[model samples]
Target: MGILDAKALRDDIVARLLTDEVDLETSAYLDRILELAEMEEAEHQFLNDPFDRSVALVLQLFQDKDLDPWAVDLSAFLEMFSTRIEDTEDIDLPTCGRLIRMAWQVLRGQAETLIERQNHEDEVDEPWIYDGGWESDFDDNDYNFSVGIITGTHKERLPDMFSGRIQREEGRPVTLGELLMGLKAASRISEEQNLRLKIAEKRRASLEMARERFSGSLHVEDLEGDIRRTWEAMRMRANPEDQTCTLSAISEELADRSMESGTIREEANAEAQVAAMVATLFLVNRGYASIEQKDAIDGSVILTDLHPDESDFEELSLRLHPPPEIEEAV
Candidate 1:
């Protein structure tokens, strides 16, 4: 295809991707596979031998809903299989067994790695927990001592009473000091007001840190919402009829054009939008939603009311867009 044709192809693909009808990342993987086929002379060979089932099989396999084409780990696949294939040409039993063993090892390893990578990525992408207070190293004894001092407890009588209780329970002689320490260790303040105050303080600190990081301009939630809205809009616009195009295909095309024009800001924005759309689509498909009901809703349904939690919003945004940069306070 000419440069113009490639550009056109990219536009069509992007249109499909933005419509939410096609899997963008999967489309990108298929495009890569096609490109590799072209480079390896397989494209022309498949054309000449149109009846070649392998070509169709490969393409169909890439498009399979159950298969994760992006997580194929092609480099690892090649590394494992290429050497084994090179060493054997016979259709004999021993050679076949070795190839099977190597293939199994490669597949098992790739599957394990893919799962691990996905889990790690998910953990990294999740929003940080804001418990509203620092996790303390102070023990119960210290806490009790602080509480006793604040409450004005008679230190002497309290210890004697605690020691008597301990002696009864343990069937042994216990000192007043030791009993006091034990009581202190066992005691915990169960005041709801105090806990709430600590949480409020922590939340204030978190909000301040976030504001400083965003230069008091954008809330993390707002930036995240913008990306998600853009993505959802794009998905709603996608056409399900286009089988060959995807969001990733469009992204790569946009990225190329943006690079050519030196429009870094535009490119970054485009990347973020695409990532958000792709991520949202993937999550929705995978049954990760506030409401797990998947009805055949019209494309025109407004996504504004779909109140996804912050973590989900962030995941959707990061998937479709460039990762947000945490700016250092000046």
Candidate 2:
């Protein structure tokens, strides 16, 4: 269809929905358009991008009633959002993040509203019973689901459980935040005042450091550039016979740089080392450096300032195992 024909159809549909009661033909017209859009290319395109089309469909279906938490079928709405798009060609991280954030806000608002309503209802003379409408088909293991239902605190997990249906047989792994929420719900643990104070203290220190870094007197170093510079320096410092440095050596160099330069305290050596390793991995990904496990030494990977050759283009896993202290603590 041409642009004029498309506009006429849209206008007619909107008019029918607004004025008179629409019939099945209206729905059939839309369905037919969607079918034709898939099967044939048109001169005028409404939504050529799959991502745009999917998002438009979501808004068309849910923008009105679904925005009202009370009017929405929470399970179905969340299920639709949680499902992976069959066509992911044009979807980017920012788009995904925004969409996920919107869904999260809606879910959070719904939870708060329901909780407040339940609290108000509890104050009434009549007692209210809850139907397990939010609960999914998963069989409760021991006291997990029962206690959560009784306490009403874990209503947030309803979405997680519902979305977890496909992975039901594999066991839905509880995240750290979910586990913490569960512990708090069961009265096993509570946030201490000292913990909050400590967090505030850390934030204050970070803010001060941020101010110092951004001030005109001091310069904020580019971490990736600094890493590359340090790698080049490492090559220069190495023997002419062996110009390469091990990944562990590079990590130690970064840790020392942070400590000696007073950018970070000596107490954070382990964290600095881990951060350095991660940064170097990013560098490797961007082709700034090449990494390979040394056959001569067990569990040792070497890094070089040389750009990766065509032979190094293939994908491979390079494991960065935890330090002995970290392993022991775990």
Candidate 3:
């Protein structure tokens, strides 16, 4: 398809993404459109168009939610911090942990600033401040020299960070690549820190929820039969070789069966959907089945007895958005 047609389709899909809260299938459709553009040798024309820039940013945001393009290293950060102190023995667990947390937040802020700069280059009308913490007494030359060293362009002539006002030049803003150096440093420091916080937060929530009482009417006794039925249904319908089935397929299949059996009068009520998900949870916890959700970005889930150990596994949280119920005919 031509770029115009592609852009129209992309816009429609993006609208759905915004309204529907990031449907992975719709995002995948956008991916396919991009691939088509690449195949037709019009990728540059498609991306460089001023009107399509917003679409590109939206697509990129969904594609890379974490957005840590620069690799962060915690050990190097700690070592560098310790070098500033004369007594390395004073470095303790609490101190190191605190520093790690602080560094993580700082990097996150820097990355956010870089992203804002990229998304709104025209709107940023002022000279961006560098938070490098170099002594304020240092001349513009010193700051520029430090930036060059950090960005690995010390040998090459670099632009003055304060060309506009410091040097009394007419108008010269800092380069995007220069701001990107901050991003890269932030990325490096965030690699270890990001995972540490996420794991800790999620684990805390998972444990807390496990201890808390379920306020819902779905009792354990109520789901005993349903859980078995759900498991058996999965075992039967799952691909014989892979023992896998999409979550949507299994849920819909069970819903249809329940409707036929008169267990549910209407088509897939919210109660019935919740029960299905709860039953699936029971099956997974009991080792009768395992879930395969490679990433939340894809938003595709599969029920499988064949557990893939290499894939990153995230604990299931109760985030279900059932489709709108079908209206009854008069």
Best by TM-score: 3
lDDT of 1 at 150: 70
Give the per-residue lDDT digits (tens) of candidate 2, residues 195-289. Answer: 54555566556545534422422224366565554455345444455556765455456667667766554323443443445556676676566
The TM-score that candidate 3 achieves is: 0.26
CA displacement after TM-score superposition, residue 282 of candidate 3 (Å):
1.4
Q: With candidate 2 superimposed using the best TM-score fit, by how many Å does residue 76's alpha carbon deviate from the native?
A: 40
Preferred candidate (lDDT higher): 2 or 3: 3
- Candidate 3's clash total is 4
Tens digits of per-residue lDDT, candidate 3, 112-144, equal 644554454333334333565422357889788
Per-candidate Cα lDDT values, in order, are 0.39, 0.44, 0.47
Q: Please give each candidate's TM-score.
A: 0.18, 0.25, 0.26
Tens-digit lDDT string for candidate 1 (1-330): 321132222323222212224454445444643454454343223332221222222333334445444333333333323333334332122232333333334344434544555454344322234353222356889698778867878465564554463334335677657856655654433344456556656655654553353342221334334434444443444344431223333344435544666656543444433344344444444343211212322111212223233435466445655668999999
lDDT of the structure predicted as candidate 1? 0.39
RMSD of each: 23.6, 27.7, 27.2
Q: On a 0 to 1 TM-score scale, where does candidate 1 land against the true structure?
A: 0.18
Off by over 4 Å in 3: 1-221, 263-269, 306-330
